[model samples]
Target: MQGRTLNFVTKSMVKTKRIPKQARAKARIAAILSATDALLRSSLPSNITTTAIAHTAKIPVGSVYQYFRDKNDILEQLYAEASKQVEELVLAEQSAVDPALGFDHINRTLLQCFWQTARSHPTFGALTRWANREHSFVEVTPGTDSSLARLIMRTFEITGINLPAARKEAVLRISVTVVSAVVDIAFEEDDADKAQTLIDELALLLSGYLA
Candidate 1:
């Protein structure tokens, strides 16, 4: 995850294909994405085929190509969309944070939002798995300067703690790394109680670190 996210922070992502203009064409494209999402829930991205997506979408294979270059292209778009959804979730939750309540309250609120969003998204775990396996180099959008990062920076800065620019970046990077590691582990556990425990510990760990 470290190498992959670092690559995202450093490199450019491949541009996707042309957008559909007409309503009918747009519907076809939407169907393709929806089919891809459904298929992804059951199979790894590498194992999914363009033909399979075409069949699932009930569109001609050539029509799928009309909107996407191939299966991987479809996956890339889906991955981008998924990341955007998660980013929005983070931003919305961050906006509701009450700064006067102190770092611990702010920390727990943000972490809970992230965990709940991840759990609610049926494809979140699958997307992470696919990303780790196939396109490790592809930069997930918003990069390292995500809304969550900005929120964290702002929270710490308001406390009147003077951190150098370099130090600020390092702190955000380590915090993101630590939280993500624990969240990833929580996602894989079958036991709901254990998953909640992992997330609780993550909140405790991050709150202490930031405090």
Candidate 2:
């Protein structure tokens, strides 16, 4: 499980025809992803097609095929980009946190950062729902050096919490999984206040378990 999770994170979830190098190529790829993102905001992943994406991106269908084999390949890349954005936001939030703050404060701060990113990207909920159905998003495991686990470990260090290496890994793994589940549920809520309430409850849950 650990090895598989690591591979999914470290390597591309799906292979593209080639990696973009030149500025024009990179811009074109970004446009393709942006087009897909816009489509997902209103359409289900399964309902979207590569030709539709090409039309939205204002490129030829062959150009879309130049980078992606099909719509699923494009969706996988879109999810990967979303995950990368979340990790980057968490890291930025972590840097600004005060070391003097306890686990609860830091946890909630980071959770808010995550929520903000997920909320801003309207495609996230639809993409996640699709990935869950397709079994494309794998469960994260301990010792995969996941971004969440590393951030949690850093939080422990800042708060001066001590535990055996094995025990710490177990706690981190469980905490990440629980937070992910709660956040997913929160994202599914149509009401803003209800979604935030779910996140607040999650902060309390983690405080009791980790702090």
Candidate 3:
């Protein structure tokens, strides 16, 4: 879990700039990010501009420039923050899971947390969709796949499963890929019932593989 969290934190740190030092600076940065998040919820990512962010944030355009190099910079920070929240959520669930109860329960808890996070943060889906386009603001990768694999290995370790060196990685990689696709489908669906059905199906699919 720490390994996966560190990967995302390191990746984000490399892309983020203009660290907030003072209280006002921190508040201003938060406002900028908040404004950017709101704009992303309603408008297309391509249509959003730094000037518009500044206007929404009620600050000068120069202030937005002070904290963020550009809109992409803001998007990068948003993604970074979202990654941290997800890592924290998974870790929190990890502590609550009893190894005796097994990975089925653990998987359900984690999946529920993931769905809740996405639902709570409207910008997460928007940023992800935007980041995949041809003129994407930020480079996207399969970072979540490795993160999921690491978390699964930790769970297996806790449960005293004698997973082989070669097969452990292979199983987890395939599990993460398939589960991620299913979750993506859930996120894309408009009907809440259908989305939840996808999540539940993912849980069952993972339990069959992991157990």
Candidate 4:
């Protein structure tokens, strides 16, 4: 989940520089991206024309093309932004980890961060799942995977988990897999309770595993 090899989608990479402070090209990007999300769930790419996105956005067709070269290009940016959101969540928490806390606290906080993010910007969750099926959107940075893995592995050092190197590696792998899987399932569930249930169950499961 952290270090998955999701790659680039198209040739044109959109520079988000032109985004004005008030106009918020970033928010506009999000709106257009969300429109594609509706398309991803409802129809194939071919079925979703620029007109559909324009109508969905209540803007002109040219506006869609303004930010992106084409549908595929915007899709790539959407995926990148989605991934960026998750990575940003994880990294922000990881940066401020308390030295006194055990790995268990860290894991719980990490799960909570992801859960909160999913609850807030659920479109990113849907976009992430959709990106899995279609490699049409994979604009992730190269170093992202190893960095996330190392962040998870650092918990072992803080908690004084005295295992052989092999065992620690195994634990890190499991943690990464479980963390991402739970997030994915929370999105897939779509029901509000499913996320709470998943997080609570995960809390118990990881507590035992850490013990």
lDDT of each: 0.68, 0.73, 0.69, 0.62
Candidate 3 structure quality by residue, lDDT tens digits, 36-126: 8889889977899999999999999999888778888888678667766766777788777788876777778878887777667767666
RMSD of 4: 6.2
Q: Clash number for every model? A: 0, 0, 0, 2
Q: In model 1, which range of ten residues has the least summed lDDT?
A: 2-11
Ranking by TM-score: 2, 1, 3, 4
lDDT by residue for model 4 (111-175), tens: 67767765676456555565555532123222324544566666566667677866866776676
CA lDDT, candidate 2, residue 192: 92
User: Which candidate wins on lDDT?
Assistant: 2
- Residue 101's lDDT in candidate 2: 85
Superpose all Cα atoms of candidate 2 onto the true structure and report the RMSD in Å to 1 decimal.
3.3
TM values, all candidates:
0.78, 0.82, 0.77, 0.62
Question: Per-residue lDDT for 59 in model 2?
Answer: 92
Once model 3 is optimally superposed onto the true structure by TM-score, how far is the C-alpha of residue 97 displaced, in angstroms?
Answer: 1.2
Using TM-score as the measure, the top candidate is 2
- Model 1 C-alpha lDDT per residue in residues 5-79, reported as the tens digit of each score: 311221233334767789999999999999999998888777889999999999998898887777877876676
Over 4 Å off in model 2, which ranges?
1-14, 21-28, 136-143
Residue range 1-211, candidate 2, lDDT tens digits: 2311211233435577779989988988889999999998888899998889989999998898888788888887777777777677778888889978888888888888878877786676676666556653344232426666677778788877887877976787777677666776676688999999999999899889875
Local error of candidate 3 at residue 164 (angstroms): 0.5
